[model samples]
Target chain A: MNTFLQLLNRVNSRVLFFGLLFVSLFLIVRNNEAQGKIFLNSAGRVTGFFGSGATAIGSYFNLRRENEKLQHEISVLRGQLAKDQYNTQVNIDTLQRVLDSTRIQIYKYIEATVVNNSVDKPKNYLTLNRGRHHGVKENMGVITADGVLGVVRYVSKYYCIVMSVLHTDSRVSAQIRGVDKGFYGSLVWRGKDPRFMQLIDIPKHNKISSKEDVVETTGFSTYYPPGVTIGKVFYHSIPPGSSNHLIQVKLNTNMANVRYAQIVVNVHADEINQLEARAKDEQ
Target chain B: MNSSSTLRISLKFIIIWILQIIVLKQVQFLPLGPYYYEAFVYPLFILLLPFGMHVNRLMLIAFFSGLLIDASYNTLGVHTASAVVLAFARPYILALVLPRGIDEAFTPSLGRLKFLPFLRYVIYAFLVYLPFYYTMVFFSHVFIVEIIVKSLLSFIVSVFFTLILAGILNGLD
Candidate 1:
């Protein structure tokens, strides 16, 4: 005990010195970001390099499980395709409507590895290995095999950052599957759990039930394609003073363990946005 | 200071940092419970700082270590701020809990202390560290109750791991 205390006293100054330096560095970095001078980009690259390396190691260990998951996904897709072919005669109008509404063609599924992900906070973001060189661009939608993940927020030459669906600032136009009209809701991660996200601004008039509803993207936002799965409603309640229902969605994608993902770059997103802007100008 | 000791300390820090960034961070013991509890290895850096190190210096190292972890994890400044705070409070916590005449220059070690004193140190460390860590992580939100609960839970789990690490390091030394 005496020796331990002696060591503690001796090292106290060193500890304090390092501690203060850290605090000052943190303050400088935080403050500098507000001034638009980011000194941490180099640090970010170093960290990113380490992160990507770690991710590679992790993926190596989980290869068997990932392979199984991919195989199952492939079979599921094949079954769905077969079923769709069979139902085409019975639902010609529905098929035509779906085809007409899908203006964007996803030419290829650009697989990117997630080097970093933040889901515990309000404004979560994800970093991917692919960027402009891989045909990935801003406004591209990202997803794992399970469901919708998020949209690309920033793109660099070889890497891209995605603002996750759990972000408070993430407003995706979505609705219950098969519902004609869509509603706008802000996705907010409650911080209690990562598997579930809270959807706000859903009108109280909409009929909702636990475990019975499927939420999908409305394609109103250029970031996601129509009918892409978002999550399933698990629980909902009307806040006391508001007319909107507070709905909790159990996300289909296990985001914490997501490894490989596809970034969907809609071919016609720019043209559609431009046309809409012109139409609004004429109006 | 001997060159060997400095080299050893630097090596330890580097090894721990790499293990934390590469191995421990990937260990997600998920589906275990409701909150997706995962082992966080960053606190081990704080626990392993040389005894008698200056509080400010310790904070700086802890902060940089945390910032590196945060940058890699894309958590921005949360880890850096919390780690600095944790390092700053360690000395005060030690003074408040440990008995007098415990030699001032002696670094903290489980092997050097009685069970009760060691337990007190562990508890104090958790109390000082957990709240700051969780607060920074959840800074944007105002859920005080959730914050307290999550912090406490994380503290309990992380403290266990820290104690084990401390024990192992002391045993090796």
Candidate 2:
């Protein structure tokens, strides 16, 4: 009788466990775009409040390094600004119309403080203090001063979630640092490492890349401006029965330490996407 | 139900919660390499609940505690699911580890269950919890490599820390 009781007890607990697990999975799956926004935003608000407090304390310890990073960025921007001013002085009359059409506010950056961030998950995300109220929108590209960060996934009144580049589903168009820019590939995280990601589907005929080869974001995507540093080629190998070289890359941004970032706003994205949608419809 | 037991459990929860978020959250598994796994001692709260606590009530508490932890960790539903599963597995794990006719009123701790049995219980409970948490986080079998590597590292580290915590709780008693 006792053995029978134990068996029934085991079966009862097993059923309870699975029933709850089913509900959890149901929550994950059903919490899609519209419904997920409500839950995520409400949760984000509470978390954001706490996270910001912790970040403020954390930021106090990091102020010196933060200042140095900003200073270095400012110096680089100063040099580029100087070159742009000189070029305009020399060629303004002839190139003014073209420059105004192509270069006038195509991409804008909205600065945001990282309230909360995680890198150790298969699907990592970051929560920023700036949100819809700050003109932050979903699908915008997030980048540090140094390297590619992620794309904005969801937005609330005063907060947003950026799906980090380390996410398994995150694929960014990236290219090797060379003249042959046409041979770019989609970079993806394999869920094992935050420090490394893989750029797959490079045709076998391309020369085996050296470890020194740098990788950067390509102009193929509306999310990021061209030439953002993504990572450097850490290693490469061709798996048997496949025609592409599996390129392992060492990510440039130390994701664990990123406390601030800029969101890329592509003014032309809607126009380009609408044009592409029309083409698809016609086909 | 009694004031002292209630106080002891509340104390356990507070100490474990702080140790988890403030201390262990900073403890990375491989500080230099891929940096995947994290040490989780918070689940020890669910593991060491009062032995007489009803399983349903335990699951409810586990779920809310997990939700609170998730609020801090930034991963919603994942830890909650793992904690509920841990709470469910606790009785079975206790049955497997404890000597027969042990008092139900007693909480399972290092002193009560003996060090080796309690260690085995932690291992067994983690075996249930980590796989569920990682699977839910990844949401795919393609990440088997990560799931295994992370689970193993988390189990080893969490068990070590939780055992120390269990010892401390026992000392308090």
Candidate 3:
């Protein structure tokens, strides 16, 4: 009985030490699982709670800059409108002189504020303040004052997530403004600086100008209106082993400081999408 | 049993968590190619836990810290699992590195050891961490080369950062 007590004591101490070690390791690991849900929930709550305050502060700081930009845009639009009104006769004459010159389309824009922006990841997403409640939906085109941002990927009641141009999965059918040969290329973030992006799959046969040619959407994709500005081709090179030319595009939109944006909701989007889907099915 | 010590530890954890979540999380220096790699600064928390702490307590602390970090980074349970592994391995590592006579009551601290012993401790700590960290991250069937490259780069960078942080904490103390 005395020997049994000693043995029990020895066993107890050893068990205790090992047990401590096991529990510590388990807790460290278990913490990860425990923390994930708790952290996310807490982050959401904290951000949601302080979101309004931060927005208010941001707006206050940006008021002057916003006013200045708004003024410049208003003046540019006014100047263009004046020119259109004065050149109505000229436009009519030109329409008669050229084929397909009279085709005019109107676009509606919904303004939204960017709440969160990420540019350094392979799959970058932007969160906006507007959502389904504001008539925003998946695949709607989003653009900043400078140019095209990306397309809306997901939507909630009060928020919408946009898969930015910086994402690997993001591709748009784009063409050189005046060139006849158009190509579908993926917009990829090179994980470098935020100001630059790479346009992949441009055929080597296509002659790319150094400085001035504009890259714009071809309207082949239902998400964007045809001729929406994307960026300008900055540089191109024939990679060592690949046949396609690697084109570097300087994005017009300054992603780092983008705040206010517009979501383009096409009225005929559903019909066009259905027709495209049927065509694909038939193929 | 002391309230002040508990408060100090909690404070330290919060500060480390905030720094990891808010500041270090944003800094991604990619020295490698298109296969994206970034340094994780959360291990400083693990390294900073009080030396010679009870094994279970240490593991619990590491677990909670890992959980907080994973949650912030949106990596579901990877950090927690790896951290727990590190916590469990820490004692064995200490035992292996420490001198025989010092095993009974020795705590891991810069002031408590010579240079070679410190280096050994750091090396062992790093070895314990690397495998678990890499395994959790690359669990999906990925290109072996990419996984190896990323893991190696991340391990090197994280170890260097951990050493610097540990040095700083020691200096401060």
lDDT of each: 0.70, 0.81, 0.69
Candidate 3 docking DockQ? 0.03
Alpha-carbon runs more than 4 Å astray in model 1: A1-108, A179-186, A190-192, A280-283, B1-173
Clashing pairs in 2: none
Q: Rank the candidates by DockQ, best first.
A: 2, 1, 3
Instruction: Summarize candidate 1's per-residue lDDT along A124-167 as a digit string, tens digits.
Output: 88998888767778988897777778889899877899988777
| DockQ values per model | 0.09, 0.11, 0.03
Expressed as tens digits, the lDDT of each residue in B1-173 for candidate 3 is 25565675666667666666776678786667776666665665665555656555566567677777768877756777677667767777777877767644333555656667877777777666766566556543344576677777877776676566556556433
**lDDT measured at residue A154 in model 3 versus the true structure, 0 to 100:** 94
Clashes of 2: 0
Clashes of each: 46, 0, 3
Report the poorest 10 consecutive residues by lDDT, candidate 2 chain A: A86-95
- How high is each candidate's TM-score? 0.38, 0.41, 0.39
- Winner on lDDT between 1 and 3 is 1
Please, what are the lDDT tens digits per residue for candidate 3 over residues A102-159?
Answer: 8533345677779899987777889987787777889998877767788999999878
Better of 1 and 2 by lDDT: 2
- Whichever of 2 and 3 has more lDDT, that candidate is 2
Per-residue lDDT, model 1, residue A149, is 81
Highest lDDT: which candidate? Answer: 2
Considering summed lDDT, which 10 consecutive residues are worst modelled in model 1 chain A?
Answer: A86-95
lDDT, candidate 2, equals: 0.81
